[model samples]
Target: MKAEISQAEKAENLSMTNWFSLLGLAVAVLLSSLNISIVNVALPRLASSFSVPMSEVQWLVVVYLLAMTCFMPIAGIWGDRFGRKRLFLFGIGLFFCGLIACIVSESLTQLIAARLVQGIGAAIFISLAMTFVSDFIPATKTGTAMGILGTTSAIGTALGPVLGGYLISHFDWHALFYVSVPFCIFALLLLARQLPDNAPVPFKLVKSGRFLAQFSENPALAGSLTANVCVSAIIMSTMVVSPFYFTDGLQLSPAQIGAILSVGPIVSALTGAPAGKLTDHLGSGTVVRVSLWIMLLGCLLISASAFWTSVPVYLFALILVTAGYAMFQAANNTAVMTEVKEGQKGVTSALLHFSRNLGLMAGASVMGWLYLFTSTFFPATQNQPATAFGVTFLISAILVGLAQVMVSLRKGR
Candidate 1:
């Protein structure tokens, strides 16, 4: 009786610690995600203040994304060698310093440089955050934990524009950077207190190579990563193209376009927890397959909306795509992380993020170019933008279809 009671108490204590750790991790996720989105609203203001063209100010956003992508893999390797908690603390501190630099910057060059520093710090924590679920959460609840992270991320994405607008309106553009400082401090303190330190591993470049080589041996990991890249590309493409489509094709005002665009992140936030529950009950593989089908269907609907010029159809399709993405993200992360070899969790997580950022960069450039190229071929008398939108989404659907086929073939084999 005494032993049973002791075991029960230990379990409860561990559970409490896990929840606290998760809270810290969630805050980190929110901070990183908010930064990704919050800066866009300030770009015009920044350009005016710096006396530069929009093209020059745009580098502030692009440089951050580029730095995050470039640094993530290295950060992962360092996390494993030096201890993730220590590295994560360093990352938060670096991010705080970057924010201070951004607030005090006198030139566009200085602000862009500060953003690069911030991105590197964001990369470190974002890559390590998923690994924490594997470390601290019970296996059965992994999906739910991932879902919570997804929800936090979606909330940050959804809130960034609104919050940035409010801050810029009431205060100054610098307030956009200032808002995150308190949250970063809180995350640092909570994580420092709650997370247990892991034993440091010997650093090796060969280990990263060996981990990459596992893609050939581990079909599940390969398929999940491939799907991640494709889905991320498709999602980013929608974000990049949809506003132009709404304006040129549907003839909507900027306010209406903003309202419509907001639906995707809102739906993603709303669906994240439920999707995670579904993943737990249905299994990650099953949830992934279903989510892909949903996304494909949504893409088709989006294509149809281009032809019909129906706002309702577009809204419904956005909900489906975003909700499906939320589901896929939770299940896919669970699947990929589940297959990580011992001692490689940090690198594996980093690779997952790298694939996503790569996809986003590709989608922004390639998809926009594709839309422009296709638009030129259409007659001016026709709804050229709408036709281009339709064709672009049809191609996106094909990509999603290809991913589903790949996953199916791998499962069959």
Candidate 2:
């Protein structure tokens, strides 16, 4: 047990790395990001193929988030108890299974179910990967390494729409799921070579549970967690309705919407590293405060654009919104990690992940409900859909703005 505890604290004496570990970490991060946006472009195709309403098609997206959210809290604890490497490998295996299942899925139900499984895999890996990085990398090098990871994840999210669009147009949507298999296998193999089993952490299940229950004991944890949920909810709420607004309202094609949606992630990926450095220099608090304002401003910009009937204005607003979100996410993650005890890091990370998932679920559900309400009352033809979506964004902006205020409240003795 003593040996196990020491192993769990492996990074206590860890030195900075070269590039191999960095590359491996990037792969893991990208996989997580891919899960988030990979299905966006496929949504239209999936909806058409499954003969489902656009609103119902969102279940495929939200179900995955629900699974990820529910499982995120425990993933970190499992990492500590079972060894982070073990958890990571298991996650990769699960991801591969999910990919295979997706490729073989025949119905909307099956596809959504498979995505939930994929979300579980992502929840496991993402939480553990963050913990592993903090454990094995030197503190001085952490920001840079994390920057790489963040940027990679953003890039994956950005690329997914364009890549998924191409794949769906040329091949079939199944190809999207199948294509990930090789990468998952490659990632698993490389991870095995690069990561050691090490020793397990002392597993006092009761103690761990008790610790988890005390999540509210840390004010920063609570605040950061709330902030995470709000930000993710706002972002996902926009995502849920954005495609429809672009394609139906603006009379664009799936390819065109894909191209537009693609811009945000690309900007995020390109800007994330510098944003990280900026966070390191300016402090997480400063970054978080600024990002929140920027995001809120973007929301207002979009709201105004909705009223003005300007597509270009909307696109410009979306770019700012995405950039601001990326900045906040990077900074908020760093702050959350710093807020908890070393032993509680995994649980905290998991909590943050959980919050994001829950936020996505909440945001998407609210948007869907609002869309229905608006469509029935205002009719589908004009910009009623946009108005419905715009209202959801306004609400999300308020929630996120409130969260930012909470983050601003400093904890004291």
Candidate 3:
């Protein structure tokens, strides 16, 4: 583990020629990013395909997230135990295999199972993609290189909706799965050609285990983790609900919903880099508090749109949520790691990743439950789906407020 971070420090001293491998790494990151968001556009279509209710079909999202959350720490351990090339290739194979399964699935249960496989693959890749890429670049250039890759994530987030929208609009949902094939093949070929034979970090899990002691004792770390979970939960819950809300409540087409929803990621992409820098200057705690306020406001705006069904209000709300999440993540992640001792960095990072994925699973699962329950209670919510979704968002906003208070009360950083 020390060897792995030491590499990041030494990256600045490497020859420029070593950067050639970054192309392959960037492709991997782009693929991961696109896969993450593209699936959102398919939720409504999946419900139709499986002949399931909006909430029931959400198992596709929830299952995948839970699988990813479960696999993250294991992936990190295995990557160290095995070689990066071998581990990453295995992950790719698993992902494509899962995609194949998804394309061929006959029922919602089968699709959810396939998605679980895909999520495992995603866990492996996402766990190592940035670190793997940094292995080939100079330490001095690592930050900029990582930031460039981060931008690709934003681009992918923006593209997922629009691309998924187009594919589902013109062809079948299968087209969306097909889209990943070229990138996967390209990444596979590139990694095979470019990566080194020897492992960069000494394979170890015991180091990651040490953080459990500190994490349990550290109030600040615990608070940061909780805040991140809540924030991520809110963000993902909105994603799960938006497609249904727009389609059922607003009577919009998949294409229209995709186009409208793309606006948030676009704003997030634009603000994300600057936000990281701002976190450095203002301090993570301060920025995080401000971000929670912005997101709370955003959630309220979207909640209001249930009554009005105003596109303008929705977009405005989306901008706040997207931008707030972008800023919040940068600061929150920085805060978590900065608070940890050097020896505990690996565990802290793993815990942070786990918390983030857990948040995704919780957000989707919880909001899905909330929406279904609200619909059952207020039967009118069946016809006006937005009302049910609006209630969910309001509940999420309350959680965020609670998160802010938690952050405020934390005794350390």
Candidate 4:
């Protein structure tokens, strides 16, 4: 009886600690994602305040992205070699300081520099957040934990524009930075108190080489990573091209276009937790296959909308695509992290996010250019915008189809 009771009590304690730790991690994830979008809304005000051109003010966003991407691999290696908990705390603290610096900055240069600091901090924590779920949560519950984190990320992303707009309107641009301070403090306290530190692994250059060799040898890992890149590019392409389509092809107002565009993120947020659950129940491979099919269908529908020119069809297609992407994200992330060799989760997780960033860059540049090139082939008729939109999505569908083929071939092997 004593042994049984002791075991039960210990389990309860662990459960409690897990709960608190997850909360801290969730808040950290939210902060990281929120900052990415929140800063965009403040660009005009920043330009005016700093007396700089919009192009110059844009560097604030660019610098942060660059810093995050460049430092991610290093952060991951450090997290594994040092300790994830310690690094995560350090990241949170650094981000907090960056926020303070942003609020106090008297010039655009100072603000941009501060954002760089925040970006590096974000790279550290965001890279490690998924690894924490893998390490601390039971394997049986990994899907559910991943889903919760996914939901939190979506919420943060969805909330950023709305929250930033509200804060900026009511107070000032500085309010955007101020709003996160309390949440950051709360996350730091909770994580410091509840999260357990993992033992540090020794870092060696040879081990990294072996990890790379292992990655190349593992079809699932390589396939999943490639799929992530393709999916991110597809999503970013839609974001970059959709507004023009809504305004020119659909003849919609800004408000209507915003409403339509917001649906994608909203659907993503709603789908994340359910998708995670599905991933758990159905297995990552199965879920990923289904998600790719759903996305492919969405792309076809979007292409059809060019002729249909129906707002409802466009919106439905957007929702389908976004939801499919969210599901794929959860399942794919789980698949990749599950495949990581012990003591290498940090680097693997970082690589996953880094691939995503690369995809976003490709989508913004290459895919956007593709749209422009395709649009030029169409004569300047009233339907020109629709035609370009259709062609772009058709190409996107082909890409997704190729990804599906790659995944299938890997599975067959």
Alpha-carbon RMSD of each model: 3.2, 5.2, 5.3, 3.5
What digit string (tens of lDDT, one per residue) describes model 2 on residues 183-276? Answer: 7887888887776454666667424543357455665667777787787777775566677666667777667766777887788788788777
In terms of TM-score, which candidate is strongest?
2
Single out the weakest 10-residue window by summed lDDT for candidate 1. 203-212
372: Cα error in model 2, Å: 3.2
User: Which is the leading candidate under lDDT?
Assistant: 1
lDDT of each: 0.80, 0.74, 0.74, 0.77
- Which model is ahead, 3 or 4, in terms of lDDT? 4
Evaluated at residue 166, the lDDT of candidate 4 is 59
User: On residues 330-387, what C-alpha lDDT tens digit does candidate 4 reach at each position?
Assistant: 8888877776776778888887877776676566556756766777898988788888
Candidate 3 lDDT tens digits, 125-229: 766565454355444344345445545566677888889888888987767777788888887887777765544344344344444565666767778778878
Write model 1 residue lDDT over 145-202, tens digit each, in one string. Answer: 9898998887786666566656655676677788898999999999999987887776
Q: List the residue pairs that clash in candidate 1.
A: none
Clashing pairs in 2: 11-135
lDDT accuracy of residue 403 in candidate 4: 74
**Candidate 2 ranges with C-alpha deviation above 4 Å:** 1-18, 196-198, 204-211, 410-413
